[model samples]
Target chain A: MTTAVLFDNVSRHFGVVRAVDRVNLDIAEGEFFAMLGPSGSGKTTCLRLMAGFEQPTGGHIEIFGETAEGVPPYRRSVNTVFQDYALFPHLSTLDNVAYGLMVKGAGREERRKAAEDALAMVKLPGYGTRRPGQLSGGQRQRVALARALVNKPKVLLLDEPLGALDLKLREQMQEELKSLQKSLGITFVFVTHDQGEALSMADRIAVFNEGRIQQLGRPEEVYNQPKTRFVADFVGSSNVLSTKLCQRLGVKAAFASLRPEAIALAAPSNGALSLAGTIAGQSFLGATNRVVVDVDGARIAVASPAAHAVPAIGSPVTISFAARDLHPMEDA
Target chain B: MRSEKSNRAPLSLKIAAAAGLAFMHLPILLIFLYAFTTEEKSYQFPPPGLTTQWFGVAWDRPDVWAALALSVKVASIATATALVLGTLCAAAISQTRFFGRETISLLVILPIALPGIITGIALRSAFSMADIPFSFWTIVLGHATFCIVVVYNNAVARFRRISGSLIEASMDLGADGFQTFRYVILPNIGTALLAGGMLAFALSFDEVIVTTFTAGQQSTLPIWMLEELIRPRQRPVTNVVAMIVVVVTFLPILGAYYLTRDGDQIAGASK
Candidate 1:
């Protein structure tokens, strides 16, 4: 399959700050890919570069194998669902969605019919005549989606498109967007800071930090085997095993990262790395209980099944995990 | 339950508001009342009789017609110049960042903030130094200097209020530069520019100080009114023309007020 979007050594610098350091990436055609990072991590900047809103300060970018250097955003064959759903306040839903077709000089009736179909795809049928002001937050989001999809571009870039919605609505939209992408078979490059959203939806995820991609892989690989300490800490809650603990466990790596769920509260078993520590505290998290164990001046968290009996704060417990669970992380 | 104190203001505040309104509007009310007075020469507390003859007399005077036409022409040209220049300046300042950006904004607004006489004196000196002849265009040029400020203020505020993402989204949706502006930027700033134009027109119509310096022999309506007041001919007719000026200028000011007030509450910009 042809590459949908490629960034070759792309970098964007604003004054002294490097927003996107030299980065190379390739997204497959018709794949749902995510650029996941915290604020100022350059995920959104990379998206903007692909959309032709901002040219790379150095290096190059390509869309469908075409060099995108100096291309104006209007000439690019991509659509964006902005974080704030920047719909035209003056135009009705129909007119706003038809804006792309209208600009291309399509006849009124033809554009209107397509806009209506697009709205229906977003489950906002019969919302054509209403202005954006009349719509609720979720409805306005749908309108923005319809507007972008009406144009039928090869790639759709979503910049935290669900950022404004309430939690429940956001989750609902996430599912809707995933199914929509699947049905359309179009490439989607979603930029977001929410790890759960990225993990749940993206076919592959690029975890970014400090203007560079720390790790890029399938969600499970990034989660299970973070290549950098930053990726380990960012992708999820990770316990960085102290050097003393690493020595005690017979691991020779500089630093090891183990997920909270990887360790469990149980009697020492054969074929597992075992450590004796005092149970410092326990917090109930519905299905699982997170227990912080203090061992040799380091606090290690162990995820225990909530069905297990709770140990007293001062009780000594042995935590065991398979030796393979300890994933060595790159030294800083 | 809703508190009564929150629903109704204190009595003193209500009285103060009423006094403030009267203070600002009572003079305009006096202008309206004097326009109908039958007395011709001396001021009277109350008009001895009311007559509509002054309106007909003011309408027939050739000089009055000339002044009115000149005022309309100058205001039209000034507003046109302001719309083009001010909107362009607003777009530039709001969209781009560079060295001295703030200074340029301050300079553009300085004419409006300074005393009108100061602007008038500066314009006169500049015109004299350049050896440019004072004519209809000169009056238009003088009025545009301040009119542009009004339009710039409105346009810049609206432009800043607009989300930058909207422009990017428009362009990302395969719209060319002109198409993005037509669909996204224009609708957002249209009302603000309209309000600014109306206000600029009203300001130019009643402008007197700058016209005094730049108009040379041309008598705009306000200048003619000044002359009629000094010479004291058909004083009631002057009052009638004053009424016309008040009505003409008042409508646009009212229109501008409503237009800008609605602008603050944009149609779909709740968040």
Candidate 2:
């Protein structure tokens, strides 16, 4: 796949603080890529650098095979849907949607027709005459989407585009945005702190922590085979156990991450990786019963079906997982 | 029961507000009333008869027209100068972070905060040192000293309220820097600029102390009014012009209030 955007050892610093440290990433063309991290993890800063809003202090960025140095955002073949929408308050919905084409010096009739079509694609047809203030939050968000998409950019940069929406609306927008990207065949660089959002919408996700990409892969791959403790913890619920490998099970790392669902709570098994512990807490989820067991000095969580019969808080239990289920992660 | 308590304090507050309004406007009302009175020279509690004959007389005076034209010209020039400088300064200050930003902001605000006489004397001394002739440009320069503060205040506040992300969004959407300024930033700040320009014009129109110090022989409408007040040849005409000033100034003030009333929400939306 052709690389749509590449960050080659790029780093950005604000005074003494390094916001983005020595980052290298390659986002493929027509890929719906997500940068997932906690706030201040430099995900937003990374997006801003790609958008040409900020220049990297070290190294270079390439977009569509062209080096992006000293390139203003407008010169780049990319568009952004800002977090707050940033629809023009003074202009009507039509004008706001048509702003990009109008700035490109498109004719009045052409802009009107293009804007109408873009607005319709977002499922807001006759909202043309209403000001942004008059529109609902979802409608305003759609207007912002239409405004960016009207230009038909090679890449669409969404900075937590659905961050402002309520849960239900955000879910709906995530699907819509994904479908829109698929149909348009344009690259999408979505930034979000919400793990669920990234997991749901991305073709691939770059999991960032402390200004570095800990792991980048398909959502399921990243979740199942996390390379770092931070990635395993960040991507999904995993019980990171401080383990001394009693025997080599073909994995190289010293520590293992046992996913809650992968662990089986039972009496000490004869031929599995077994650890004895006392149950410290228990909670019953609808489908699964979660039990936290204190193994040595570490607390390990295990999830099993409610039908499996969970142990009491003080009951001694041996939690075991198959050798393959013990996913090893690099030491922190 | 809730409505009763809610209404009680507001009722007393309304009465107090009304009293304050009367206290402020009673003198202007007197001027308006006397402008239409039959009595031409001396003051009286109530006029003998209502007539607009003095308005006709005021209209006929060549000096009144001259002063009115000069005032209009000075106001127009000063407002234009202030708008350009103020907007440029505001955009410059808002777009970048530098050393002494707060100090620069304070310096920009100092002209309006200082007494009018201080600004006037400062401008006078500066003009004297430069040996520049005090003509129409001098009056405009003097008016602009304070007018720039008004425009800068409005523009900077409006600029600060706008989200930097919006500008970034615009550029990311394929708008050049000029296009972003023209389409995004300009449209967003239009109401603020209008409010600022209106206030600057109003300030320049009635500025007497600064104009007196800056204007050598050229007289503005307020200076003319002051001359008329001292020597009562056409006292009622001065009242007539004062009535006009009140109306002109009042409309823009009302306009500015309404424009800025929803400003907070505008800021929130941009963010």
Highest lDDT model number: 1
lDDT of 2 by residue, B105-169 (tens): 88988999899999899999999999999999999999998899999999998998787877877
Task: Classify candidate 2 by CAPRI docking class.
Answer: medium
Report lDDT (CA) for all predictions: 0.90, 0.87
- 10 residues in a row with least lDDT, candidate 1 chain A: A236-245
Per-prediction backbone clash count: 0, 0
i-RMSD values for every candidate model: 2.4, 3.3
Query: What's the DockQ of model 1?
Result: 0.62
- C-alpha RMSD between model 1 and the true structure: 2.5
Residue B106 error for model 1, in Å? 1.5
Write down the RMSD of all candidates, one decimal each.
2.5, 3.0
Candidate 2 lDDT, A250-302, residue by residue in tens? 45676667789888886546667777889999898989888888977678888
Chain A TM-score across all models, in listed order: 0.98, 0.94
lDDT of 1 by residue, A1-332 (tens): 99999999999999899999999999999999999999999999999898888888999899999999898887788899999898888788999999889988999899999999999999999999998988999999999999999999899999999889999999999999999999999999999999999999999999989899999999999989988888888888788886777887899988899999989888767898888989999899999999999987689888889999878998998888999999988884
Clashes of 1: 0
Q: What is the lDDT of residue B8 in candidate 1?
A: 92
**Individual DockQ of the candidates?**
0.62, 0.51
